[model samples]
Target: MSRKVILTCALTGAGDTTGKSEHVPVTPEQIAADAIAAARAGASVVHVHVRDVATGQGSRDVELYREVVRLVGASDVDPVINLTAGMGGDLVIDPSDPTAQLPGTDLVSGLERLPHVEQLLPEICTIDCGSLNFGEGSQIYVSTPDMLREGAARIKELGVKPEMEIFDTGQLWFANVMVAEGLIAPPPLYQLCMGIPYGAPASPGLLNAMVHLLPEGAQWTSFAIGRDQLRWVAQSVLLGGHVRVGLEDNLYLRKGVKATNAQLVEEAGKIIDSLGDAVATPDEARDILQLDRKAGAA
Candidate 1:
């Protein structure tokens, strides 16, 4: 078993979660501050997704990402920043015309989905492994195989490590395929995203199945949303994987209990320490993720 387990704190996500947790940072400055707090609390990496300042809704603006990168980089804290490249794939197909795009649909190209990552060239970014129905209905997360290939290639060219976000078994399979296709670099990385509606359920059995599907020599981490967050944190570590926790995935420490991003990271660190596994520091995770001083150099 690996003695050091990396802790990743996803600061904010694209989901409509601003109202759910007051601690969820929306603006670039707030996000940067929360990221620094998370890093100081023990997170080796901070996964970020910017939101529109006016509406607190999710956004993919390059300038927003640029500001976030600048603020975080210039801070005293130096955690590896992993931008979310999982945007620009929303497809809310209309029931009337299956062929025609719906009103709420937000479809963008694989290349277009990465302007922020390309601009900032952060230490890491995410490339969702595959597409999946986001929720109970027609809301879909569309990342086609070709799109994934394109995104991965771009991230590679930018010297950004693409954390393969796997929502289910098929996504993991495709991630392995990308490895074979030379779209990604060696020692492939994965992020098991659990409990997102129709995607992989947040259960130990399912998490194990997905974990087992990882490449023989891959680095991986897993997270579950809502109340399942801590469960998956421990589960991932038990499965020889890393752990992720923060306000993005879960808003509360427990029922009727809210938590800050730093509190979440500290809680996860304590859990890992209790399990006889040390929480990896920024330097330790840098070595594990092969991150160098340059953004995204592994």
Candidate 2:
């Protein structure tokens, strides 16, 4: 367990939740500013996913990614920018006509997902480790083995750290395989995403079990959705893992309350401090994750 805990604040997720809450940053400026605020609040990393400013829907435009990276990187507040490579994988399948694609299936190819990362080689990018049934909708997030291989390969080529987003145990196995295939460079970085429907349950037992199963030399973090977000912060700390917080997996700071990414990160910092541990600074986090090329060579 690293003595220092690195905090990651996921700004705006790729979900269609903009209409749900005004706190969700929809424009590029809003997203980047919110991320900068999170960094100022003690987050060492900012996980980002752009949404269409017009409709507040998910978007994969490279221009948007550039705008976000520019805002965060050029700002006085500097946190490791972790752009999401987990986009364009939404697959809404039809149960009735199993073979026929659903009308809402906006699934995309692996190469199509790389433009953002290719254009803006952020410090880190996320690779969804496997497919899962996400949200209350009839949507099943898709990440096929072939697609995963392609996406992983691209991530490696771009020299970006691939943060493996694992929602289940099977995904961990596949992540291990990716490490073996040299898709992701070692010491693997994992995010055990919990409490979402059709995935692993949010519990200490499950968290411990998943943490136990990480590939050797892998660095991992865990977060539970909704109200359990704060609880999972302490849980991850106790389990010897880092933590991630923000509106991506949650919206409220408390019951019926809207929370900004900075507030969420500030809360996470408090938990880390209470545990007699320091939240890693951006530089310290870069060092810990071996993102500082100099440190890696050393």
TM-score of 1: 0.96
Off by over 4 Å in 1: 296-298
What candidate 2 gets wrong by more than 4 Å, as runs, is 292-298
* Model 1 agreement with the true structure over 1-298: per-residue lDDT tens digits: 5489989999988888898878899999999999999988989999999999999988898888888888888889888888998888899987687787876687898999988877777888988888898887678889998888888888888878889999989888899999988888866889999998889988889888877777778999999999989877889988889999988889999889999999999999988988889988888887888864677322
Q: TM-score of each candidate?
A: 0.96, 0.94
Q: Whole-model lDDT, candidate 1?
A: 0.87
- Per-residue lDDT tens digits for candidate 2, residues 1-298, read 4389999999999776787888999899999999989998999999999988788888888888888888777889978888888887877767776666775576888778778777777888889989888766568888999999988988887778999999888998899898988888877899999988888889799888888877778899999999999989999998889999999989999998889899999999999989888899999998888883421110
C-alpha RMSD of each candidate structure in angstroms: 1.7, 2.7
Q: Lowest-scoring 10 consecutive residues by lDDT in candidate 2? A: 289-298
lDDT (CA) per prediction: 0.87, 0.86
Candidate 2 residue-wise lDDT at 274 = 92
